[model samples]
Target: MEFQQTGELEEDVWFDDVDPMLLEPSNNLKQRKLSVALVDEEGTDGLTKHVAVDCEMVGVGYKGQESILARVSIVNEFGKCVYDKYVKPREKVTDYRTDVSGIKAHHIQSEAVLRKLLALAMRDIQGQMPISRTFQYLKKEIYFSMTFKEFKDAYEPCKKQVEGIFLLGPLMDKVTDFRRWEEFQDVQREVADIFKDRIIVGHALSNDLKVLFLGHPRRKVRDTSDYKPFRRLNKGSKPSLKKLAQVILNKTIQAGQHDSIEDACVAMKLYMLNRKEWERSNKSKGVLKQTKYFCTNDSKSIKDEKRRKIKIFKIRNLQKKRR
Candidate 1:
C-alpha cells in the first residue's frame, strides 16, 4: 500500500490506553534531588555522544496469527534511561501479550500524558548541542552545503563531536511507529533533512539500513556487527552485543530487557576493538616503484653443457637486434 505522510501532525496529541511506566523517571520529580555544581571537566565538553533507541511492544495476535507493535522505549548513548511509552492499540488487547508486556487495557486510558512524556524525553536527549554533520543522510545532498572532503572527513568523527543515533532493528527499513505509517515517514524525512552525508556507526548496520530505508555507502558506514576480531580464536556469525559487552567491557547488558543506549555503546566498543586490527592489516608505508617482466616457460631443464646465452652488449646493439 502507498502511504502518504504529512508533517503537520500535532506534536502534543496523546494516545489512549498507553502505560505510565513507559515514561522515564524524571529527576525533577524525585523525592531527593542531588545538588552538584556544574564544573567544567578537563578535555571534555558536556554533550551527548550517542543516542540508542529500543522498542518494547505489546504484540497482539490479530487475524488468525499476526503480531503488532504496541509500545516502545528509547535511551541515550550514555546509558541513561530517556524515553519509554506504552501505546494504546486501536483494537482490543488479546489475552496472550498481557504476561509479556505487563500492559493491559487499564494501563493506557490516557494517551495525552504519554505523548507529552515522549516529546520531553526527545528534547531532553537533544539538549543544546548542534547536530553533527556525520548524521547526514545523503552525501550529494549535503555537498552544496559542505565540501565532499569536509563531509568525508566526518566519517570517522570523534565521539565528543558527533551524536550517534543507534537503533536496535535493521537499518534498511523504517519501523512502523505510532500505529501510523505517516509517523515513520515523518521521522525519516526529519532525520534525512537534519543529518545529510555524515557517518552512521552501528552493528549489523546493513540490516539497520534495511530498517531505516537509508542507503549508507561503503566506507561511510562503520558496521561492528560484520567485523570479526580474533578470528582464529573466535569464529561465528559475530557475537551478540550482550556477550561482547560482558567479555570486552566487563559489564552486563541486555539484562531483563534490551536497551538501545547500551546497544549503541556496545556497538561503538566493538568497532573500536576491531579498528586496531583493520589498521594493522592496512599498514604499508614508504616510497615504492613498479616494474614488470615476462618469464619464458620451459617443460624440461636443459643440460649445462648444451646451454647458451644471448646477450646484447649495448643499447644500440639491442636496438639493432630488434630492428
Candidate 2:
C-alpha cells in the first residue's frame, strides 16, 4: 500500500518539468459535457471501465519481421497488476527479442517433469491416459520438487554459439506442436477474456491491439504516444514510450528487460495526469460519439431491409423523372 503512494508521487514528478502551457487542465473546460451513455443495448461490455494494457511481442515469420504476442500485462487505474501471463503464439516464434522482451523459451517451456506429473494426475482422474494423443486435450495440475541434477536431466533447450552470442536452436518436434497443448489454449482464452471487451489504455496501443487480435473502441483507448497535447513533444510523429516519458516527465522508462506491468503502470499514470482534460476534448471527437443503430437479430430481416432500400431507391428515381 505504501509503495503505491510512492509510485504515484514519482509519476507526478515524471511530468512536473513539462511546459506549463501543455498541462493546462482549463484548456478543455470549453469542451466539457456529459458523454454519450454507455448503452447495454449496444451489447458493448466493459465500456466505461478503464484498464491499462500493454503487450511484449516476439518476432516471427520471414526474417522475424511479423510480430506475435509473447506476454501481456494489464493494470487498473490504481497501478495494480490485473493480469500478466506468458503466451505461446499460434505461429512459430523466430525471434525472442530477449533485450526488450526478456523472454526465453524456458520461461514458458513446459517442464518435462511437470508434464509427467500432470500425466499422472490425468491418469488418476480418468483411470487411464487417452490413447488418442493427437490433441493434448488432457489438462491437469501437479506440484513437485526435485534436485537441480534431476531438473537438468529432464529439460534442455538446445543452444548454438555464434560470435559470443548464444541463439536458441529449433524447437523440438513436440514443442512445435503446441496447438495440442491444453495450457496454450487456456492461456489464450484467459487473456482474451480480460482484454477483449475492456477499455484498454497503453502506449503504441494500436500495435499491441493488433498482435492480440482484440478490438476496443478508439474512444476507449488512451494511447500515450499519440495524445494530442504531446504532438509537439513527439514532433507530430509516433514516438517511443521511453521518449515520451523522458521528454514530458523527465523520467526514463524501459531502461532494460521490459516489464509489462511497469509499462502499463506508466501508461496509466500518463493517462491519469491528463484524464479529465483528455476526456473533455474527446467529447467532440467523432470517433468517440456513439451512433444509433437499427439492429435486428434475423438474417431474413437484414435481407429484407437491403431489398427495401434498393426498391425505394428505384421508386425515388422514377418520381424524380416524373417531376
Candidate 3:
C-alpha cells in the first residue's frame, strides 16, 4: 500500500494499474462489469485497522431533490473491496443520476421486476388461487403463511424465468451481479456493524453517515475532506476527493461518473500516505482515544440532557433576578 516518493508520480504506480473501466462507467450495459472483490480474512489479522468507505446516491422524493443511498463500497487497509452492494431505496427513485452516480435502472431491482417475481412465487404456492388473493399475498402478508419449503418451491420457477431473462441479451450480462437490499434498514444495520469497531476513512464522510443514520466516534474517523493538510491543498476550503486524487495522487478520478470503490480506494490511499503523521497529530491533539464506541445517545439520555440544561438555565435566570 506504500507508494515511493518520486519527483514525478506515475499513474500506474499511484493507482497500482487499476482497470480504467473500474473508475468509469460504460453507457452500454453489456460492457459494464461489477468490480467486486473478496476480502482476505487472514490479511486483516495484522494489518492496519483503518477501512475506507464511500457511498453513491440516487435521487428520491419530489423532483429528484432528495438523495438516498443506492450503492456503498468499503475497502480495507490494502485497498481491497470488502463490501459492495446496491441498495433498494425505501422511497421510489425518481432519478438514477446515471451521469453522476452511474446507477441505472438495471442496477437495482425495480418494482415491476419485484411484482413479477412475487406473482410467479404466489402462483406456485397457491395453485389456481384467485387473482384477488394473489394480489393480497403480494402485499407482504403472504410471508407469514408461507413456510421455507413452500417459498423455495415458489421461487424455483421464478429463478428460471430470471435466468431466461438474462440470456435474452444485455440484461443477462448486466444483472447477473446485481445485489440489492430488500429493506433499506437492513443495509443500515449491516453497515453500522461493519464500522462499529474500525477506523473509517473517507471524504465528506458526514454526508454518507447522515444518509445511513449512523454515527462513529470522532476519534475513529479519518475524513480526507476535513483534514487540515488536505484543506490547505485546496486553498483553505474543503477539497473535493476528485481534486485530492488529481493533485495528491497525480491521477484522474470522477472524470465521467462516480464509482464508490474508486473513491474509497482514493481515500484509503490518502490516509495510508500520511498514516504516521496523521496518527501522531491526532494523538498530540488528545483526540486519539482508543474506545470502541459510536456517538449515539439513546432517547432517554437525550431527554435527560435536555432537561438538565433547561433546569440550569432556569437557575441562572433566578440568580440574576435575585441579584
Candidate 4:
C-alpha cells in the first residue's frame, strides 16, 4: 500500500542483495523486467509516496499540429484530488478543443476582460434588489443565504434560469499569449515539487511529462502502459488507459470526454490490483538476465558440437569407402 523511500521496498524484492530467484530455473522467467532504469536525476529520496497524474493537452501547432498542456490533475493514493490546474500555453492557442477538453475561451480569459463585462451586469442586478436593504440583510436573502438543503433542492429545477446567463458569444476567438501567464508557471512549479522524488503512476506518462516540461527520475515512474502483466490483455501491445480500466478494473472510463482525474484514479487502481504480483515477478529480472546469458552461450556450443559430429561422421564414411 505504501513504500519507504530508500532501500526498504527494494530490500524486500532484492532479498538482502541476493536475488532469491537465483534458486529457480534460469529459463523460468515469465517475461523481461518491465521497470524503468534507476538512473533518474531528479529522484525523490524520502518515504516512497505515489501520486497518480493525468494531463489534458490541446493542439498548438501548424494546423493544430502540436499538443500543449491545457490541464493537469494529480490524485493521492486514497483517490483524493491533490492538485488540479488549467495550464495556458506560451504561444497563441490554435484550438480550445471543447469536445474532449471542455475548455472554453472564457475559462482562459483574464479577470480584466471578464470583470468589466460582469461589473455592468452585477450593477444592473444589484439595482433589482431593494436598494434600501442593509448589506447584512442582503446576505440573508433567498439567492445569497440559501442553506445547503435549499441549494441542492433547487439546483436541477433552476437550470432554466441558470442556462441563459452561462452562455457567451459562441466563445470569442481563442485568446493569445498564454505562455506569459503567471498561473501556468506556478502550476508547473507546484507539480514539479509534488512529483519530486515521489513515484508517479500514470498511463502514457512520457507524453504527460513532455507536455508539462517536467523531469522525474525514470525509476520513480510506474507507467501502466508498459507494465508487463497487463500486456496480455492487449495482445502484447501497450494498452490504452480506457482499455486497461475496462478489462482489469471491470469498469468503463473515457466513454465520453477525457477526464484527467478519472484516468489518474483508474491507473492507480489497476496498479494496486497487481502490485504484489508485479513486485514478486520483478525479482525474476535477475534470473531472466542470467538465463539469457547462459542460453546464448548454450546455443552457440550446441551448434559447434553438431558441426563436429557431422564432420566426424563424414570422415568415417570416407575411410570405409576407401577400404
Pick the lDDT winner.
Answer: 3
Instruction: List, residue by residue over 1-323, the lDDT tens digit for candidate 4.
Output: 24448754553333353333332332222322343121223543232388889988776644665667788988776566677777756555677676787565444545455534433343445446543342333223211344444433433342232333522222212223323333667888888899876778899887787666666655566788877656555545677887776655566667777888888878877766567776566556542233222122234444554575577579789999999
User: Against the hidden reference, what TM-scores do the models get?
Assistant: 0.38, 0.54, 0.59, 0.54
What are the RMSD figures for all models against the true structure? 30.3, 18.5, 16.2, 23.4
Q: List ranges where model 3 is wrong by over 4 Å.
A: 1-48, 111-182, 290-323
lDDT over C-alpha atoms for residue 27 of model 2? 37
Model 3 residue 258 lDDT? 93
Model 1 CA lDDT for position 220? 42
How do the residues 94-118 of candidate 1 rate in per-residue lDDT, one tens digit apiece? 4424444444433443334333432
lDDT of each: 0.39, 0.57, 0.68, 0.59
In model 3, the clashing pairs are: 166-172
Model 3 per-residue lDDT at 284: 87
Model 4 CA lDDT for position 305: 45
The alpha-carbon lDDT assigned to residue 137 of candidate 1 equals: 28
Model 4 residue 308 distance off true place after TM-score fit, in angstroms: 62
Query: Could you tell me which 10 consecutive residues in candidate 4 have the lowest summed lDDT?
Result: 166-175
* Pairs that collide, model 2: 14-249
User: Which of the two, 1 or 3, has more lDDT?
Assistant: 3
Please give the lDDT score at residue 273 for candidate 3.
Answer: 72
